[model samples]
Target: MAGAGGSSWVPWYEHASPVLYLEQLLGNVLKEVDMPLEERDAKLKFADRLQSLTQKAILKEYPNTHTNVALRGFGSFASGFALKGSDMDMVLMINGPDKEKLNFKDIANALKQSFKADGLGVYIISNTRVPIIKICEKPPAWFWEEQEKLETQAAVEASAFKAGDGKNVVGDGANNSETSHSMTNAGVSGEHSSESEAEDEEEKEARLRRKRVTEMANKTNAPKNSKVWYRERKLGKSDFPKSDAGILCDINMDNPMGLENTHLLRCYAACDVRVHPMATFVKAWASRRKINSSRDGTLSSYGYVLMVIHFLVHIIQPPVLPNLQHPQDWPGLQDLLHDEQSQFFADAINGHWIHYVRNVDALNYYGSKNISPNTMPVGRLLTEFFSYYGDPISGGHSWQGHVISLRTRHGGVLDKGEMGWNRATSEMVNGIEVRQRYLLAIEDPFETNHNVGRTVTNEGAGVMRREFKRAVSILRGMIGRGTPREDLMEEWVDKVVVDEGGQGEGNVGRGPVATDGPLSITASLARIGM
Candidate 1:
C-alpha cells in the first residue's frame, strides 16, 4: 500500500500484482493437476529414484579426499525435487555453502548425468524448488557428458550409505546391516584376510559416503553467521553478541520466507511459470540471499521457474485460465485452467503446501510497511507476502526513521518518510524488517541504483527476518557493537561515505545505477535479515 505497495513512483503491476498472481497461480495449478492418488505415489517414487542418481553422481565427481571434504566439511549431495516436465530438479549443494564459490548449475549437471545413466531424462528446470533453484530442462546426449562430469567421476568410486544434499543432513552411519560381518573361510586364513579386506573396503566406502554428507552439512551451514543472525532475530544482541541457539526461526521449515515466498510471487509475475528446482536458474538467484549478499540481481530469469511451475499444473488438471493472458489469473481467472502453463502449476498446487489462507493480515504480509517486492521482475503482493514474511517487529523498539548511512547527501539516514518521494531507500514499517535490503533507490522505476537505506540495527523480529548480508550494515552493527577499528576491514566503513552521487546502504546495487547516485562503498551488495 505504501509506495506502490512499497514504491509510490513505480507501477503496482510490477511490485504488488506479482504477489497476487503467485498465490493464485499456485492455488489454481494445484487444483487442476498434482495428479491422481496413484500418480502422486508414482512421482514420489520417481523422486526417490532421482535422489539416488544425484548421490551417486556426487560420489563419482570428487576424489576420496575431496569428497570427504564435501561430505564431512560441507555435507554436499543431491537433495531432491518434485520432477517437472522434461526436466530434472536437483540440488548439488553444500550446507553452509559459500555461494561465491559453488556454481549451482555444475552440481545439477553432475546429478543430472547420474540420473541419465539410470535412464531418466536429464533436463535442468529452473525455480521448481526453493534454494537449489536450478534445473536441467532436458539435456542433449552431447551435453549429457558435460553434465555427467559428476556421475562419470562417481562411477569410478565405490558408493557409501551417507550423502549430502545441503538442506538435509545424515550421519556417517548408513543402513547396511545385511552385510554386517565379513564372510570368513574355515580352510583359508588368507582368503578370510582378503574377505576382511573387502569388508574393510565396504566400511571405507560407507565412511566416504558419510564424509560426503557431513562435509556438505558444514558447507551449507547457512554461513557461520546464520547462527548469530538466528539469535539476533529473537534476542537483541546488545549485551550478548552470541548465545546458545534459542527460539530462532529456522528459515528452513520449507519456509514461507525467502525462496518459497519469492518463487510463488514469481509464478504470478510470468505467464507459464514453473517450479522446477532449477527455477529461474536458482543457482545464482538463490545464491543472492546467502553470502550476506544475494539481493535480486539485475536479471533473475523469472520466466524459467514461473513456467516450470505452470507446466506442472497442466500435467495434473486444466489450466487456471482457459484463455489466460497472464499468470495472475491462474487458479482464479478460470480461463487459465486450460492454458499451456497449467502443466507446471497443477503439480505445485497438489504436491506443495500451497493454498489460499484468508487469515493473514497486512502486518503479516509485506514484512515491514509495504516495501518493494522481494525480487525484481515479479513483484510481491501483500496477501501472499505474509506467507513468506510473517509479522515483523513493531512499535517504538524499532528505529522508525531511515538512517541514510551510505551517502552523506542526507547523511545515510533519511527520516520523515521521504520514501513517498523516493521509493528506493525509504519504507513505512508495518511491523518489522522481514527482508534484507530496504530500498535500492528512490528514483522512478528505481532505474539506477542511487537510493538510500534503512538500518536494521535495532529492528526487532525473527532470525531469518534479520539476514546479516550487507557489509555496510554488518560493519555498522559491528562498529555499534564496538568491533575494533584496527581489526576491521577498511572496505567496510570507508565505503559508507557517499554524497549526491553516492550509493546507499539499504539497497545494494542490483539494478543499473544512476551516475548521480551514491558511490558504492568498498563492499559489494549485501543482506543481513533472513
Candidate 2:
C-alpha cells in the first residue's frame, strides 16, 4: 500500500540518517529487480531440458564415435547473479573424440538438422575463436517429456539394481530368457542347474518389484493437464512456455576456463549473502546507464561484477569479502594446494594456472572474523563503492594507468604498464585486423593475459567516466536535499537524454534532470564541488 519509500511524505533527512535511507532505497530496488523464485526455477529447468536435448541430438547424429555428451551452464546463470531476462551461458563437453579433430561445422549442422522439425531455432557462429551454436527458442514440450521419461526409467532401473546384487538385472521376460540362454552357452548344465533355477527365481522377484514401483510411479505422476505434472512439480511452474521460451542459450564445445570462472564466482557469492545483491545492483545500475555492453565498445556485465568484488575485497576497510583465489589469505587452502586430487589444485588452461579455494564451507564468515568485522550495511557499502570509483579525490580508485586484478591479494590494483596492457594494440581476428585497447584495464582473474576491459573504446571509457561522475553528483544533490529514498532511486536510475540540437555538455542534456527543481539540484551539486 505504501510505495517503495514508505508512506511518509517528509524527507529522510528529517527523521533518519541519509546512509540508512540510502540502504532502504537500495533494498527496495533489489526487491524490484531481483528474479522471482518461480522464474529462477523455470530457467533452471529449461537449462536441464536444453542440455538433455543437446546430448541426445549429438549422440544420435554421431552414434558410433560420440560416446557421451554433457552440457554445463555457466556465467551469471550458474553463478547465482542472473537477473530477469538473462541469457543462459553453457558449455558442451563431448567424450570419446579428439577435440581438435572434431569438426565444429559438422557438429553444428547435425544439431541444426536434428532440431529443425522441433521448431527450435539454431544458428552456428563460426567467425569467433570458439565456434558456438546458439539456440533461440525453447524445445517443444514433447522433447522435455521424452527426456523426463528416460530419466525416470534410468532411475527406476538403478534403484532396482541397487536393491538386488550389483549385477545387471533384467526386468523383462525376454531378457530373462536371454540370460538363461547365455548361461547355457557358458556350459552350466550338470550341478549348476539348481543354482540357475534359484537365480531365475531371484530375478523373477526383482522383476516383479520393479514392475510394482513403475506402476505406482506411473499412477501417481501422471499428467492431469496438458503440462506434465512431474516436471511442473519439480520446476514449481504451472507451465513452461512463457518463462522458458525467452531464455537465449549459447552452446560451445570447449570453454573449460569459462566454467571454472563461473564456479569461482559462485563460491565468492556463497561466502557472503550481501555479495550477490551488491553485484546485481551494480550490474543493473550499469545497464541503466548504458555502459554495460561489451559488444558496443563498453564494459561487460562480468567486468562490472569484478569491479564490485574488487571494491568489497580490497578497497573497503577490513574487507567485506576475502580474496578466495589467494591461498595465503585463506590458510585452510594450504594443504589442498599440492594435492592433485583436490579441487583446489591448479588447472592448466591455455598456459594459465586457474587455482582457487573450492571449499566454500571453510571460507564462510571469513570477512567477519574476531579481528575486524566488516558489517557495513549494503546501502553504505554501495555509497562507498560509488565514491571509491567515481570520486578520485575522495579516496576513489584511480583507474588511469591501473588495472583491477582480483587475483592480487594486496589492494587488487595492478600497474597497466607492468602488465603490458597500457597501450592499444592490434591483432588478427578471423583474418581481419582488430584493435585492442586497454583504456579501462581489468585483468581476468585466472587468464592473467586477458584484459576484460579490452573491449572498451576510448569514447566508451569517457562515457563511463562521465556516468560515474554524474552518479556521484546526483547522490550528493539528492542526499543534500533530504530527498525520499524512492525519489533518490528514481533520480539515480533515470536515463540522461541528449537533445538533437547538440547543445549539452559532455552528453548531459535538458531531458530527465535529477529532480523537478533543477536550480536547487544544481546548487546542491555545486556546493559539493561536482
Counted clashes in each candidate structure: 147, 1
What is the C-alpha local distance difference test score of each model? 0.27, 0.58
The local lDDT score (0 to 100) that residue 189 gets in candidate 2 is: 14
Which lDDT tens digits does candidate 2 get at residues 1-530?
35566864543222335566667767877887788888788778877777667777777766667355788777777878877777777777666655555666677777766665556655444333445565757654654554455446645766878898565533343333222111111111111111221222233333344344334333432212111000000111112343546666766666677777777887778667788888988888776666765544467777788899888888888687767777667554455445554356467877788788776555443423422267877777777777777787766677676789898978898888887887888665444344557888887888777777765654457567776776666566565566543343332322212122222223323222222222123321111112
Query: What is the alpha-carbon lDDT for the whole of candidate 1?
Result: 0.27
TM-score of each: 0.23, 0.67
Candidate 2 residues lying further than 4 Å off, grouped into runs, are 1-18, 138-245, 330-343, 364-372, 478-480, 484-530
Task: Give residue 54's lDDT in candidate 1 (0 to 100).
Answer: 52
lDDT tens digits by residue: candidate 1, 1-530: 45545754532223333344444444544444333455445444655555565557655664242321121100001111221221222223344334344445465557646655665433332111222222222333444454355344333322432343332111111321112211111110110111111222233333344344334333532222111111111111111112231111100102221233233333332322232222322322222332111111111122123222322332112322111223243333343233443433222322343332111222123222323222322213222222212222321111234322211221123443554422323222232112223332211001112221211111111212332222223223332233322211122221111112113332222232222212232433233222
C-alpha positional error of residue 499 in candidate 2 after TM-score superposition, expressed in Å: 11
Query: What shift in Å separates residue 403 of candidate 2 from its native position after superposition?
Result: 0.5
